[model samples]
Target: MASITASYPWTTAPLIAGAPMRLISGPSLVHAISAAGGIGFLAAGTDVSTLSENLSAFKSLLSTSPIPGAPSDVLPIGVGFILWGADLKLAVKALSELPEPPAAVWLFAPSSSEELGSWANGIRSATKNKSKIWVQASCVADAIEAIKVANPDVFVIQGADAGGHGRYASAGLISLVPELIDAVREYYGNLNGGGDTSSFPSPPKFVAAGGIADERGVNAILALGADGAALGTRFLAAEEAVIRKGYQDAVLKAEDGGNNTIRTDVYDKLRGTIGWPEGYGGRGVINLSYVDAIKGVSFEENEKLYKVAEGAGDKGWEEGNARMTTYAGTAVGLVKKVAKAGDIVRELRGQRI
Candidate 1:
């Protein structure tokens, strides 16, 4: 498989990417990562109404200082969508009409491969294939289906340790990354055309996500055969990240992830954001809300309390007692302090580059 730089010729080596966190990954954060030689995705999760405005803001930032090697025909940043809830019509209009659409589009959480295919096809059509497709796969079946159907330019393998949203039935990166890679290779090696790959579809680059915060994590995934690494929780600690101070502090204070964090639908249910597919769940540092759920607290009561917490503003995110949804991965513990988004990308890329 080709490396990320092989696909996006403008990016730096040992490629790092920022995961699209809704309301958190805004224009400033996206621009910072791209400026630091890593690509960042603006979270257009379910709403495309503001996408054009956001893209315009990014362009405004670039006007003062342009990234070297970035193509004039396409913006260096990416945009992400949660297919199940996204309005497809608006999405197409934004990409098709926005001057110099983003160079990449990261798609996630489609109900089926057909849905994924439709999105991939629509995006390619709208961008005239100038934008590359990046599909996030949480399991082997999803990866294989994405390959056979969408043939995306990049396959983001998200493991169970991921924050925000991920498959409830999933393995960690140690097992999932290599298995998906092998599956892709096997699929290609067994094509009926008899040792002829000249006509075979090219495999997408593999980028591992989940529980990765530093150089050691990057080295581990590269050893497992990933082209690069993408981080969600680590970036949540970035100064550019549009997160509340209390939520950011919670991430910094979290430790011993195995003991302090959990993956469950309780957080979603309490927050009244509940329409995920059957096998998906969110991981976050355990708090009173989850602890009460474990102790037989009714959903009605928990949700009632959550409403009060919502009005608490930043105070709602207090450690050990937070009722606010602090969506984060198990690697929340590894993120010790808040730094500039560009600096976070540079630190993760490290001296090895």
Candidate 2:
């Protein structure tokens, strides 16, 4: 078995500091993860303005969260994007505008290996800084292809149980992670520099994703040969996650029956994100609208109800109807309280399971 260790300069044992205990992977969550010594990523694919503001917000938070006795140069956050819909130009613009570059850039929902290759090349050619490239993979083949083409610093294997827009045929992390590690090690040969394809002097770090909500999940992944775990659904329950309070409550309320989290094709079709692969799907709670729409009630036919449920119009925030079928994962059961990011990371690190 390979001994695991923290790869980057950042501390690893102290996970989750001031983490936003909500479902959204926003700035607070990012900073909390970084503060706790776990790498956090800012998902900035929503819009250009929001993305810019978020980056600025992250910087401000980092500046404020610095340890009193620690070094002044400590930065505790990274950034990521949905590879398929990523606005590379905008990302570049954000990076250039920022006082400093992110520690890493996570890429998910990639359209193809070629696109990842291009992205890696662009990132390599453009920046002289030390920002690592992290990519998410849904398949063994995808993982291998990405590692070879992009040579990402880290590869996150998002399993089927993951929330948000992951692959439809997503395998569980247990099966996929070790396979990916073995494949990587095989492809790269011995990281000790004896094998034929050993480009680097050491093995690249691999992070596990999906269903990783607590310490048992963390320890399991570590035992499975992963360097660490990338938690999403669990962190959504954190207090600082930028999501609706109602949604957070829903996650907490439904914790007992966490199996209610379902993977379906309805949202993708409704949201017009049909560009995804054929077998790919998403996971979320089955809501009234979702159940109602399937019974021969089309979006056009139920536009008003859908709008009402989705909180239509200008004062929609007041209506509070956008709770049904929101993205989540099976790990939602483990999330009982909306703790800070730092606390969650600490719990996971101290977890013996």
Compared with the true structure, all predictions reach lDDT values of 0.86, 0.67
TM-score of each model, in listed order? 0.96, 0.85
Candidate 1: residue 252 lDDT (0-100): 90
**Which portions of model 1 miss their true places by more than 4 Å?**
192-201
Lowest summed lDDT over 10 consecutive residues: which window, candidate 2? 14-23
* Model 1 lDDT at residue 294: 92
Clash count (model 1, backbone only):
0
